[model samples]
Target: MFKALVVEKNEADGKTSAAVQELSEDQLPEAEVTVAVEYSTVNYKDGLCIGPGGGLVRKYPHVPGIDFAGTVETSADDRYKPGDKVVLTGWRVGEAHWGGYAQKARVKADWLVPLPDGLDTRQAMAVGTAGFTAMLAVMALEDHGLTTGHGPVLVTGAAGGVGSVAVAILAALGHEVAGVTGRPETEDYLKGLGASRIVPREEIAETVKRPLESETWAGCVDAVGGPMLARVLGQMKYGSSVAAVGLAGGADLPATVIPFLLRGVNLLGIDSVMQPYDNRVRAWKRIAEVLPMDKLDSMVHPATLEDLPQLGRDILKGQVKGRVVVDLNG
Candidate 1:
């Protein structure tokens, strides 16, 4: 028997509890790989899955962690073996199937990515899905020919996981970073991540009075959507693009096409779930090359399985910053 954090619905009580339970491999889902989960991370989606009807989790007693890193404890596939370190993201495993909020996980062999040479299990989880999403955003911007010479890149939801990493990455690559966040206190933190300037959330969230506005940014990594994205679309430099990665602000995008027709601004949508394997490999390689561990370490908070319930709730409320790496072995 292996220890796992199992979620259960007590229908009469109409509440959920995440608790340690002994489970057998036979009870685990049928998959080619079995990972001894060393670390997992809490993300925005995890919060929704844990909370009341975030419209993500459809059932009770679910183990919800979208990203994890660990060693292969068993493998029926030739590509992996016992002691092979691997990482996982996407594949809709956490929401639709079982996930990493446990001591062990069984998953399809094709879903695993070999741990890039420079990172360990903990650090891998530190990047997790959030950082992977951030990496993808940067790559999308790069494909659009965004560079330091074009002026400052704007990162919305700058204090959150994806925004925080994007801020550091773009800045590290010699581009100026202008961060937008709702919290004033995160100004210093954002600046520390190399944000050259801080743009108030209100600045971009205001109702757009014009179809387009004065060009303000080289490119954008936007985690908040809705009106915020609508406004950012208008203010982008000619031919610039915004990598839309999250809908924390809201889903409805009340926007105009003037930015697209007139300035040629592009809105690139990024989904970490089900990205092609080659692209996933390239992203992790890029992350290994570019991500500064010191900065990643600075943005992290350590948690255990016991803390996930509260941490998950906080993430949904937008109260959590950086990353929450869950040390399952602890």
Candidate 2:
């Protein structure tokens, strides 16, 4: 038996509550590999999964953790063996299937990536799905002619996990990074992670009156969607691109096509989920090579499985900063 954070629904009241419970191995979903989950991270999705169903959790008594890093304890798949380090993300494990809120997890080998060299299980979870998505956004921008010398790159929702990692990676790659955050207190924290400037959330939170503004950012990794994204669209430099990563602000895109047609600006959609294996490997390898350990360390807020309930609620309220790495063994 293993300890897992289980979200059980009270069918009578149609409400959900989460708690740590002892679960048997037979309770694990059918899969090719069983992992000794060492670390997981709290994400915005996790908050919803841990609280109300959010339509993501299809059943009662769910385990909610979108990403985890661990070691293989048993494997029927030849691709991985016992003691092999692995990372899991973006296969809808937390939402649609059993996830890594437990000390043990059974998952398909295809959903797992061999933990990249130069990173341990804990550090891998530190990056989690958020940082991996950030890397994907950065790579997408780079593919579309984004270079360090082009101009300052903007990272929206900058104090959040995705924005924080994006800022660090862009800064490390020699790009001038402007981090956008509503929280004034995080200015120093964001700067510590290599953000050259802090762009206030109010400055770009609302929709702009003009469809096209002065070309400011050469590239952007936007985590806050809604009007902020709409505003950023009009401000992109000519022929530049913005990688849309999240919709923390809202899903509505209330903007004109003038930026695309007139300024030749491109808006690239970044989806870390269902990314091809080769690209996933490439991204993980790049993360291992480029993301500075010290900078990543500065962004970490550690927690344990027992702290997840409150942490989940905190994340939903945007009260959590950087990444919340949950050490299962701790």
Candidate 3:
């Protein structure tokens, strides 16, 4: 038997509770690949899955971990075999299906990617789904004609997982990175991650009034998609792009199309889940080559299976910082 964090619902009260339980391999859902999960990570979606359904969880008695890295223990597919290391991020594993909050996980082979060279299972989990999405955002921005020396590339929700990695990667690529964060205490943290300037959240959190602020940011990787995103849309430089990754603030977009019509601003929607396999491979390989390992190390905070419950609660409250790497064997 192996250990897994299981969430069960109290049907009468319509409430949920999570606990670590010993489970057998037979309990796992049928899939082509069975991974000996070494490490996983906490994400915002995980917070919802660990507590309430958030419309993401399809059923009860579920496991909640959006991403993990490990060695393949068994595989029915020709593409993967025993002893090969792999990584998984999207495809709703922790929601509609069994996930990586356990010592082992069985998943569709198509959802797995070979772990990039120079990254161990633990290091891969350190980069998790959040970091992977951050890389996607960066790639989207660059594909739309963003380059260094144009101006600062703003990263909204800068202290969070995606923002942190985006700031580091953009800075590493010789771009001036500005991070927007509400917490003043994280200014130093953001700067340490290669951010050159720190923009207070309040500076851009308000709804757009002018609909065309002086084209300030050369580009943006936005994880906050409410009014903050609306405001940033007006601030983007002419013909530049803003990659919308997450909706931490809110889902509503309150703004005008003047930025698009007048300044030629491009809003790129970045979807990590359901991404084509070829693009996923390209992003992972780029992450391995571009992201500095030391910066990635600084973003990591270790946790065990037991710690996930509280971590989930903390993440929902927007109190968690950086990345929380969960070691299955810890």
Native-structure RMSD, model 3:
0.6
RMSD of 1: 1.2
What are the runs in model 3 whose C-alpha is more than 4 Å off? none
Model 3, residue 63: distance off in Å is: 1.0
Regarding lDDT, does 1 or 3 come out ahead?
3
**Prediction 2 TM-score vs. true:** 0.99
Report lDDT (CA) for all predictions.
Answer: 0.89, 0.94, 0.94
Candidate 3 on 56-75: residue-level lDDT in tens? 99988999898999999999
Off by over 4 Å in 2: none
lDDT of 2: 0.94
Selected candidate, larger TM-score, 1 vs 3: 3
At residue 49, give the lDDT of candidate 1. 66
Clashing pairs in 1: 7-61
Off by over 4 Å in 1: 12-14
